[model samples]
Target: MKILQRKRKRIAAVLFTLTLMLCSCGQHAKTEQKHDWKAEAETASVYCVGKDDCFLCGTDAGYFGQNNIGIVSLNSFAVMPVEINRYDHNGQLIEENTGAMQMENFQNGENGMTVSVMLEPDRGIAHISISPNGDATLDLASAASHLCCDCLAELVSQLYGSVNGIGVVNFSTRRLYVLQEGVTSFGAGDYYVHCDYEALGGEIKILVIYSSLRYENLK
Candidate 1:
């Protein structure tokens, strides 16, 4: 009799497990992957890529503000150019410069970068600046002068730029928004088509890790 009762209990448990698994599917909630802010700031790499081809898990990244100063973790970051200036300087090395998003490969116009620590939570943390170059200046000549960031998921890999993908985590909103530039994808041949970020200062997107959209208020 006891053996029969045990068999019945096992079957009941299996049914419950199956039910839970079925219920868990089809949920589209954005969850933040917790990390130490200090650790991220300590080993951060600032970079950029043509916002054209870069995409998310199959979804077109869509265009962002002209100033795409986005961020992603080291492990998640894609390997792009090491630096911008080759002869006069060495790889975005402007003395105090920590690093850059060398977007020349993906940009169509005057490629420029602006640096900032405004994303920091408070004044106490603001002074702990990430880039040694004291918030690199924006490409004044370029058309775009703001910042946008993106991070990709398993849906589909970006056409170009950093493979890790860039995204943001908003604790207050309990939401995480991934950064993507446009709906279309750009290829090697396309690089020269719109190439003019240097002279025209068009849409420039940087991979950043900001906490809020307050950057929209940047002067």
Candidate 2:
């Protein structure tokens, strides 16, 4: 009887986990269909185009010097050419592909400067703050629009695979944390968390900033 009880308990636990994943996925699907992705992408693009261009600042920027600008990366190496674009300082399209990345909102704040930008392929826009000391955090204004369902679930799993709503995830050794609140981190080895979690119509969206130049596989 004890063995039977143990098996039942295990089964129950599995069922519960499956239930949560199903619920989350269902809610996310509904959320995606409700939002206009193209509109979201355009809006994100327009906002950043008006701001300053600085790619070097987002990923773990403290190691950089005054003469050194920063680097940008994709979530994965499977970069398709059409996914990137180049813009002149005048905001003129130097060259563009189906997907484009634009950096903006490079300014000084009490903690650090707010880094705002957009990534194509996914076309999510994130507004994040970094301290002069290289600490990373995101605010309410930070958002990830135009995200896809698969990417959403994958990103969620990266944060310890918790289904209890999208929340803080720490890969401290990698010096990476994502989708959290009031962060005070020292460093990490990789870009683990790629988005800030924003709840919309029962679904979650992630807004992210890179603390290092490494392109994370948010998908």
Candidate 3:
């Protein structure tokens, strides 16, 4: 009788676990089904083309005493192009693949800055500031824009080192706004608790600025 009872309890526990798994899967599927990925991709493509060009400033100089600038844009699939041209003072261009992690649906912020997004500049963009120096701020209000949280964190981690750089991430906490249609939103907090990826529907935005400390190398 004791053995039979133990077996029954084990079976019940397994059934409960299976039920939970099924329910979680069903919820995830429902969320994905409700989102319109095709529409989002189309809208993002149009916005990428129509939006003003943004710039990324690196810490070192590829020109004469000036930080190299990266022109940023989103492609049809919402991925940023890896090949960026660094233009010299005379307008001569040198192409280099920066090997920077690509982001999705990223756009220019105030003053056409690639990494910073100002939803309402006057009121100040809502953000969870991460770095103590106030260089890394995670935008908390952008709905349609998205990037990879891990990529943003990787950039942020680089900031604390000897490297001359800054980073930012933009994400939404709104329950309804899914960053990437079918992608899960809960794991975004692995980077920074305050800059919760779920806050941006599992999407992150980044802003990195490199100082011009290496300008002498170009000369």
Per-candidate count of clashing residue pairs (backbone under 3 Å): 48, 15, 7
Considering only N, C-alpha and C atoms within 3 Å, which residue pairs clash in candidate 3? Answer: 59-210, 59-211, 170-205, 171-200, 172-199, 172-200, 173-199
Off by over 4 Å in 2: 36-219
- TM-score of predicted structure 2: 0.20
Identify the candidate with maximal TM-score: 3
> C-alpha displacement of 53 in model 2, angstroms?
26
TM-score of each: 0.21, 0.20, 0.25
- Give the whole-model CA lDDT for all candidates, comma-separated: 0.27, 0.33, 0.30
lDDT comparison, 1 vs 3, better candidate: 3
Tens-digit lDDT track for model 2 on 1-219?
Answer: 999999999999999999999999999988744644344344444323111222221333232221111211112101011112234455454433545455444433343322333454233223332221122322111222212333332333333212221123222221112333333232323232333234333222334433456466886
CA deviation > 4 Å runs, candidate 3: 2-10, 26-35, 41-88, 93-219
Clashes of 1: 48
State model 1's lDDT. Answer: 0.27
Which is the better candidate, 1 or 2, if ranked by lDDT?
Answer: 2
Better of 2 and 3 by lDDT: 2
- lDDT for each residue of candidate 3 in 1-219, tens digit (9 for 90 to 100): 999999999999999999999999999888755554344434443322111221112222223232222212211112122112244458555445444443322334322223322222122122221111221222221211332332222222322212111222221111111222122222221122123333233234322232224346655
